[model samples]
Target: MPTPSEPVDEFDATSSTAADPVLPAGYSMRLLDWADLPAVHALENRLFPLDAWPLSFFEEELAQAVPEPDGGTRDYRVITGPVPGSASGTTATGTAVTGTAVTGTAVIDADRDAGAGEAADVVLGYCGLMCVPPLADVQTIAVAPEAEGHGLGTAMLLWMVAEAARRRATDLLLEVRADNPRAQRLYERHGFEHIHTRAGYYPGDASAQGAGGGRVDALIMRRRLVG
Candidate 1:
């Protein structure tokens, strides 16, 4: 187990995600629908240019909501609304989410407002999880730049842990950038053990955004649950 006291990574915390109860005022979270793909995809490129997932990745995941691996299932969620009382109702670093950016919706969700526009449904963050019984993979979790420093990260992680447990996942797995010390701290707080360091795992030019393959390490973390 990597101790919390261990030195954190030397690089800046790049990725982000957050929770509801711990979120700032005016924040909310719900299952992500096809409508949110455009917004989230844009954010993904911006937030993780090097490792950005292709639009098809989300499409494929959304295609099958119930991925029965002869074991568990899958889950994807997003946080809506902006930070209260702030300009644009989001954190200072928050970027506006507009429907004009991406195209297509995988599933028609009646509960979501089709005409809500970006303001009414400003997205602050999102997360993805896969629970395959004894083995669960945390596909991804991201908090908007504006939503960082708030309790959103902790809240989102806690939610994942609980959700994985609920789906009978005895172990939760995720990979964190070697530079993201803040995220590592958060995971460590939740009893995640750093089991391995994958050399050159993050392949993208470290100096440029949206550039192709470069060398950056990744820390594989795991947590045991009572499921």
Candidate 2:
């Protein structure tokens, strides 16, 4: 039994030739909102069909973090691509607001180029983070199948790291499907190292994960946060 903290390098890789959507100038990031839930849920269902969380979870997350000042609404933003040359991603340091009570879901997006007619402000991807003792756990990250290679996942992860730092998190941990090599590469690029493995982590249909999937393993990964 290996501890979930041991670091290792090397992963089984996958090669899928997929084109990513074109993005516009100055991609922006902001908190997610209730209105964006439908799109987010759609992407999640597509990306994690086997283990998608119930819709109720989404509603609950948002409800929990609602700010009381204006009646139970969370401090979230629906990141829309700002006018080009307009500061869409710009935010004042330390003034980033949080919900009155930290009970609901917080959302954000990479939506800088959409308004320029270069891309739609649809959620090409999203990452979830939750604070725990010592570190922030990356709850999950999923990108639309069509948005695969646009580096949206990487941007989301980095944003989460910054968010975690704002919350005083010291490290980050996440579990990856054993068969997802491309994702593993993305994680590696972000300084995440394999810490351990979970056997039979993902169940597969015989059509896809047949004999080749027998050795399916989930990789537990961690990245140390640095100032």
Candidate 3:
């Protein structure tokens, strides 16, 4: 494990997830375990208060982190797999969930200096890529306000790029609030080009104007993943 104060990879964006999907070079990313829920939940709630999914949702995701050793991962979350109508459900509030975790995988790893016990996986700054056959999305990447600088966000994005490519993902996609220029810049630096935009995407009065008047837009960005 690398120490917190150690110098991180400045442009360490290249990594392969074929055999070893663990963190690349200066950073580390690992499969999420049941114990990581508390920290993940706390970050989700804090970074995305209006959109954070419930605790039960996290349980289901962790449960389906990978395919069962005997057979396969259950499709209780409509994540993928051949199930007649197996599909993850979401509330109007932007909470997408699965009754059981998806059969695929979920991963997390932060700076070792982020401290151990609970805070380790809390995503002081982190990124995730969800692979569900034929599609892969940069599910989420967040950093605590205090960790904003130090290039943690860029490192996380590079990790996701490597993960998506390893999954043989055709295209990598993610949606960021149009209002967040800093995030957009980070995405742009890593070959993500804007593909589309959604009007009134975020549902909250995070600004003084309120949800509609101060409606936030979501920019859907994409990066091709092929040789």
Which model scores highest in TM-score? 1
Q: What digit string (tens of lDDT, one per residue) describes model 2 on residues 85-177?
A: 223453211111110101112232333323433334555555556655367777666654334333445556665555555455678787777
Candidate 1: deviation at residue 54, Å?
0.9
Count steric clashes of candidate 1: 8
Q: Per-residue lDDT tens digits of candidate 1, residues 174-225?
A: 8887766667777887789999888876664656545654666788899988
C-alpha lDDT values of all predictions: 0.62, 0.51, 0.50
TM-score of the candidate numbered 2? 0.62
From the highest TM-score down, the ranking of the candidates is: 1, 3, 2
Per-residue lDDT over 1-227 for candidate 3, one digit per residue giving the tens place of the 0 to 100 score: 23353223232235333222223234344555566667666756655655666879767755655653433222111110111111233111112111111111122223222434322323344344576545667765665443443445555565556555655567878887766666677667667899898887775455657434566678888888765
**Could you say which candidate leads in lDDT?**
1
Return model 1's CA RMSD, one decimal.
10.4
Clash pairs of candidate 1? 16-142, 16-143, 17-142, 17-143, 18-152, 19-152, 203-214, 204-214
Worst 10 residues of 3 by lDDT: 75-84
